[model samples]
Target: MKDTIEGFLDLVKERNGHEPEFLQAVEEVAETVIPYIVKHDIYYGKNILLRMVEPERLISFRVCWVDDSGEIQVNRGYRIQMNSAIGPYKGGLRFHPTVNASILKFLAFEQVFKNSLTTLPMGGGKGGSDFDPKGKSDNEIMRFCHAFMSELFRHIGPNTDIPAGDIGVGQREIGFLFGMYRKMRNEFTGVLTGKGMTWGGSLIRPEATGYGTVYFAENMLKTKNDSFKGKTIVISGSGNVAQFAAEKSLQLGAKVVTLSDSSGYIYDDEGIDDGKLKFIMTLKNEKRGRISEYVKEYPNAKFTKGKTPWGEACDIALPCATQNELNEDDAKTLLNNGCICVSEGANMPSTKEAIAAFHKAKILFAPGKASNAGGVATSGLEMTQNSLRYKWTREEVDNKLKDIMTDIHKSCIEYGTEEDGYIDYVKGANIAGFVKVADAMLAQGIV
Candidate 1:
């Protein structure tokens, strides 16, 4: 079994040796999914996983735009149309300085399983550019988004490929991209999500990913006959995912004590209440300010410069920041501090060693693909709303989102249970998500 796994990984590495992030994602899935394939005769000798690892189409193009200094700038953009067996290609578009083929490929690959777990008709795909949106004027962002979409428009459609926001790409960027798509296609369609609510965007879309992570954690706790009634929670990242996870945890009677960013984490022993959360929404969404500013607004909070909040004691921890932000030492610290539950709000936030540590400790740990799927799931809902030319109320959308998260949790349990009465959610999510796509690929026959 070890040799088989190594051989498979060798093939992948040979093809993607330059892509460390992509290789890491593949290796993680292979560790669990390969064993399942070996046991399931239907999957063995099929090379289905190999086919899934390779993208159906990879589009690359140049994006040129003008900055405030009246200088022309160029950036590379890409879209990995990963798989469309179950439905259309669906994922988010990131605009960060770190965008690359390896990162986008990894994200697109994970999206395949994450979308399948959601039980949505969407498939997996991802696109992005190395363009940084920070410090850019509104006009500059608009120009870049428009240029990016001008090239992207030729390859995507409402029913072909649907893109949403990720990292640097937000509602403002989406608005510009959508505006360009509408002009080029000469029609208003849901080619993109994360739009302003007044313009065909779904309610709770911004909060869905964060809310879903907490909801999954709640379900995990329920299995142990517990709840978040008065638990202390520490969440990393101060963006959309972190803020919303904090909000939902607070609503469920949990004390959210931390929220972090690139600078560092802020620890509020008093807990971030509704007013504080509102301030965060404005700080990040409107003001575009750094998290350090949070200390000035609230004297009770202590800002830890250049450090993660994982060291802070808490009952639950959510890594809502970027990839590989939490490592083995951080996981060990959390375990030592008596933290019992960990849910991911960012893609691949926890390192491989951290995951192994969590598994060894038997803590309830969820990978980002499963825990943070709500963002894409709501994007799926937004796609549905666009097709129907109708909108759902906040209550309606929120209920659906909650139901989907509950169902995803159930799916994880159905496949992830062990003889020792422990739930290896990582294993469960990988296999459960794999089966659906594998079966679809089988039915479709070599596409």
Candidate 2:
């Protein structure tokens, strides 16, 4: 309880009543920035933190699209432009039935700092629709994407706000959205990331977050004189992030045994190799299906219901699913199972209870703001490339992404190296990211 912004927080709690995710975010920053605000003694009551937590703009629209059966389907679409103190709003569009204002607020609030931590000229924003892509025909998906982008196009631009892919919105979705944006705006720009290679998309953008998480984990492990080699890992969420995390882990000589989806978890005693991963990509991205099919295809794998892949013996855990997927019980399972490292690929996947458990266990925990920043970092690069009308090669972009992730890891250590020698990544990421935005805010000066 640092009282740097006590009154404002109290007001929020009075109004919102124990907004755990929101309160957790504020607490994480208060522990770090309070000292700095006291030392600086400049504009304490300006409500910067309060305002930063709140979104700059929240657009909620009614999206109406016609499905393949000549039926008009309607859904709620949202774009929460959280902050723009540093640069244009940059983040992802996740289309899932679970999306709402509170969830999007938590996500967009986290994105502000995550983008800042990348050391990129980007701010924070997140957009999504509650229309689930699962069980939808390609034409239906295309119409939904087009309708969503039609409303979204008016708000986002390359130099203003940029959107990328998340859980449900992948290449096909991006293509449809981009096509709609182009048709409406009548200009070609980097309004979106995760575009096809034939378009404005950059190379290696898809693999950035997953690869970067492992890279950050490796950097953290290196301080303890170790690496990913011979490590057994359990990764949740068999999406793009989890798939590439598996790929990178194999490349780093680690074995990943489990990957899950919304339905349930799949446990493979043997490692999830490239073949299995390809099957997953097809299953998830192409077929738009569940992960239980993975077990059916591989007789050696076992599918379990209503449980995560934790409790299996492992050295590392990567939770790539949505927020609050991992809780206190899951953290205890990981700790009891001898898991040492936890890096988040999704935004705030671990709850406060889970984080406290890891802290109590003294495990190496990297927050999504620090670990999963690779995606937005590359999105910023995409902006730069779009500005210059050039595309960097995969190796070139990947090398730079690696450097950025390393720098982010170093930044966390530099700021998070505390008296107890445990890195408070929440503090490190919030403080480190805040400095850049705070400076920009100061320079802009009463604008």
Candidate 3:
């Protein structure tokens, strides 16, 4: 089994040798999915996994726009239409300086399984650019988004590929991108998610991913006759995912202690209540300020510069930040600190070594594809609302989101249970997500 896995990875590495991030994502899935494929005769000799690893289409173009300095700037943009076997290409568009082919490919590959887990008629894709939106005037950001959509619009459509916001891309950026596509196509379609509520946006879209992460953790806790009530929760990132994860955790009677950014993390032992979370929403969403300002607002919270919150003792740790944010050492620290659960709110936030540590410890851990899928699931709902030319109320959307999370949790448990009665969520998620898409691909023939 080890040799077979290595042989497959060797071939994949041959083609994607330069793409470390993409290779990492593939290796993680291959480790778990390969065993299932080996045991299943229908999937054997089909080379389905190979086809899924490769993108159906990878589009790259030049985005040219004028900056506030009246100078022309050029940035590369990409859209990896990874797999459309189940449905149309669906994912988010990130606008950050770190955006690259490797990163996008990894995300697109992960999206395939994430969307499949959602039980939605949507495939996986990811598009983004290396354009940094920070420190830019609103006009500058708008111009950049417009330029990005000018070329991206040619490849995507309401039914072909619908993009939402991620990382640097948010409501304001989505508004500009959607506006360009609408004007160019001369139609107001759901070509994009994460739009303002007044313009075909779904309620709770921003909070979907965060809320979903907490919901998943809650479900995991239930398996052990546990709950979030009175638990000390430590979360990373101050963005939409972290903020809303804190909100939902607080709602469930949990104590959220930490929130961080690139600069550093702040530990608020007193817990980040609803009021503090609102302040953080303004600090990040409106002011676009650094997280250090949080310490000033609440002096009781100590700011730890240039570090993560893993060292703090807690019951649960939600890594809502970027990929590889939590390493093996961090995982060990969390385990040593008596942390019982670690749920990912960001894509591939936990490294391979870190995951192994958690598995060795046999603690409750949820991967991003299963835990962080709420964002894409909600986007799928938004697409449905758009197609019907109707909108659902907040309660309706929220209820649907919760049901989907619960279903995902059940799917994980169904496939992830081991002989020792311990749940291997990673294996369960990878296989559960794989069976649906692999079957769809097989039914559709060798596309």
Instruction: Name the TM-score of candidate 3.
Output: 0.99
- For lDDT, the strongest prediction is 3
Candidate 2 residue pairs in backbone clash: none
Model 1 clash tally? Answer: 0
Compute the lDDT of residue 340 as modeled in candidate 2.
91
lDDT tens readout by residue for model 2, 1-52: 3454676567666755646676666666665776666666563656567667
lDDT of 3: 0.95
Candidate 3 residue 103 Cα shift, in angstroms, is 0.3
TM-score comparison, 2 vs 3, better candidate: 3
Measured over all alpha carbons after superposition, the RMSD of each candidate to the real structure, in angstroms, is 0.8, 1.8, 0.7
Sort by lDDT, best first: what order?
A: 3, 1, 2
TM-scores for the candidates: 0.99, 0.95, 0.99
Model 1 lDDT tens row, 1-447: 999999999999999999999999999999999999999999999999999999999999999999999999999999999999999999999999999999999999999999999999999999999999999999999999999999999999988999999999999999999999999999999889999988999999999999999999999999999999999999999999999999999999999999998999899999999999999889988999988899999988999999999999999999999999999999999999999999999999999999999999999999988999999999999999989999999999999999998999998999999999899999899999999999999888876
Give the per-residue Cα lDDT of candidate 2 at 352.
81
lDDT, residue 177, model 2: 94
Worst 10 residues of 2 by lDDT: 1-10
